[model samples]
Target: MMGVAAAVFALTVGAQAPAEGSDQKRRLIEQKIRLVDTLINSPAARGAAEGQEAGSRALIRQGTQAIDDARKALADSRYDDAARLADDALRAVSSASRRMSPGEGALPESAQRKNLQDLGDQVAMYRNSIEELSRDAQKGSAAKTLLGHVDGLAAESRQLADAGRVGEAGKRMAEAYKLAVEELSRLRAGQEVLLSLKFDTPADEYAYEKKRFASNEIMVDMMVAEGRAIGDKRHLVDGFVEEGRRLGVQADEHAAAGQHAEAVRLMEQASAQLIRALQSMGVPVF
Candidate 1:
C-alpha cells in the first residue's frame, strides 16, 4: 500500500512540474511581447522607419516580420517560440532606432551643446595626435586624404552650431571622432598581423606578406568609405602615414632580393612603429 502511495505521489509531482514550466514560459512570452511593442512604438523607432533611408526600411521590415511571427506563435500556445521571436523583434527595432540620423530627432539645446562639446574634445585630441605625428614623418597621401575629410566635417559642424542646428553639429562631431578611432583600431590590427608573421617556406612567407598587405589596403579603403558615409574623416598625421609607406617599400626591396625573412622582419618593424604612434596618440590598442 505504501509503495502504491509513493508511486501516485511521484506521478502527481511530475505532472505539476510541466504545468509550472508551461505557465512560467507563457508569462515570459507575454512580458517579451509587451516590451517589443513598446520599443516599436517609440519615437526613435518611428523616426527610423518613416524618416530614414533604405537601411532603416529593411530593419523595420524585419522587425515587423518578427512581431507577426511572435503573435502567431503566441496564438498557437508555443510559449518558448513566441518569446524568442519577440526578443528578435525588440533587437531589430532597437537597431533601426540607432541607425536614424540626428536630424530626424532634435535634441534639447543644453543636451546638444553638451554632446557637441564632448565630441569636440575627442576630435581635438585626435587632431593633436596627428599633429604630433606630422613632426616625425612627411604625411603620406592617405594621411592627407583623411585630414581633408576631417577639416571639411569640422567646418560643417561649426556652421551647424552657428545656425543653432546643434543636434546636427553634435552628430557630425561624433562621426568625426568615430572615424578617427576606427582608423586607429585598423592600424593597430595591421600591426598585430605583421608582428605574428611566420612561415616555413620562402614562397609561403612571400604569399602571407602579400596577403597581409592586401588586407590592410582593403581595410584602408573600407575605412575611407565608412568615414565618407558618415560625412567624416580620420585624423592621422603625415609622420604616422609615412612610416607605413616606408616599411612597405623596404619590405618590397627585401623581397626583390629574395630575402623573404628580412622582408617579413621589416614589415613587422613598420607595423610595430605604427602601433606605437597610435598608442602615443592615446589610442587604446588592447
Candidate 2:
C-alpha cells in the first residue's frame, strides 16, 4: 500500500511540474504581448508617417492583427504558437514605430530641391488647366473665382519655391495642385466624374454602383457576342471580368457586414474594372 501511494504521489508531482512551467511560459508570453500593444499605441507609433504614411499605417495594421492572433493562441494554451505570433507582432510594431519617428529620415538637399521643383511644375500645370477651364463657354462666376483663387495659390507656391524654402514650397504647391484638381473635377462633374457623384446615402451609392457594374457586364457580353473579344483582347477582357467579379463579391460581403461605405467603394472599383474591360473591347469608357 505504501509503495502504491508513493508511486501516485510521484506521478502527481511530475504532472504539476509541467503545469507550473507552462504557467510561467504563458506569463512571459503575455507580458511580451502587452508590451507590443503598448508600443503600438505609443506616441512614436503615431508620428513619423509623412510621405510614407500609407506604408507605416499598413505595418501597424499587420501588427495589430498579429497581436490579436497571439492573444487567441494564448487563450488556447498553445505556448509555441503564442510566442511565435507575439514575435511577429513585435517585429511589425517595431518597424511601424520606427517609421513613425518624426524627422528621422530626411531626404538629401538635392532630393528635396528636385521634389519641390517637380511639385512646382505640377502646380503650374494645374493652374494653366484651371485658366483654360475658366475660358469654357458655360463657366459661371463662381467657377472663375475658384480659378482665380487657384492661380493665386500657384503664385504663392512659386514664390516660396524661388525663396528656396523647400518644405514650405512643397506644401503650398501640393495644396494648390489639390485645389486645382478639385476645381477641374467639379467643373467636369458628370457621367465620367465618378467621385463627383452625389447620393443621399451609402446604400443609394451602392445601388448606383451595382447598376454601373451590370451595365459594364452587359457591354462585355455584347462585345463577346459581336466577336470583338478575340486574341490578346479576349485575354485582357477576361482578366478584368475576373477582377471585377472578385471585387463585387467582396463588396457584397462588406454590405452584409453593414460596412456600406466600404461596400460602395468596392462596388465602384468593381464597376471601373468592368468598364476597363469594355474599353479594351473597343468601346470608349469616358
TM-score of each: 0.39, 0.34
Please give the CA lDDT of all the candidate structures: 0.56, 0.63
Task: Indicate the TM-score of model 2.
Answer: 0.34
The residue ranges of model 2 lying beyond 4 angstroms of the native Cα positions read 1-105, 191-286
In the range 1-286, model 1's lDDT, one tens digit per residue, is 4543332233223323456677766665565556556556655556556653667768877888898898898899876567667656756664564455444352346645755665665566566554444443544445555656776787889999999888778667766765665654443353432223346897576655554443332223233444421211122312333344346566766888999888888776655545443443444532
Task: State how far residue 180 of model 2 sits from its true place (Å).
Answer: 1.0
**Predicted candidate 2 versus true structure: per-residue lDDT over 31-137, tens digit per residue:** 55766776676544544333457777788788889989989988998877777777677667655643432113333346446545555554555556556667777
Shift of residue 33 alpha carbon in model 1, Å: 7.4
Off by over 4 Å in 1: 1-43, 46-79, 105-118, 138-152, 182-286
Model 1 poorest 10 in a row by lDDT: 229-238
How far is 176's C-alpha from truth in model 1 (Å)? 2.5
List of clashing residue pairs for candidate 2 = 48-100
**Global lDDT for candidate 1?**
0.56
Please report the TM-score between candidate 1 and the true structure: 0.39
**What local lDDT does model 2 show for residue 165?**
70
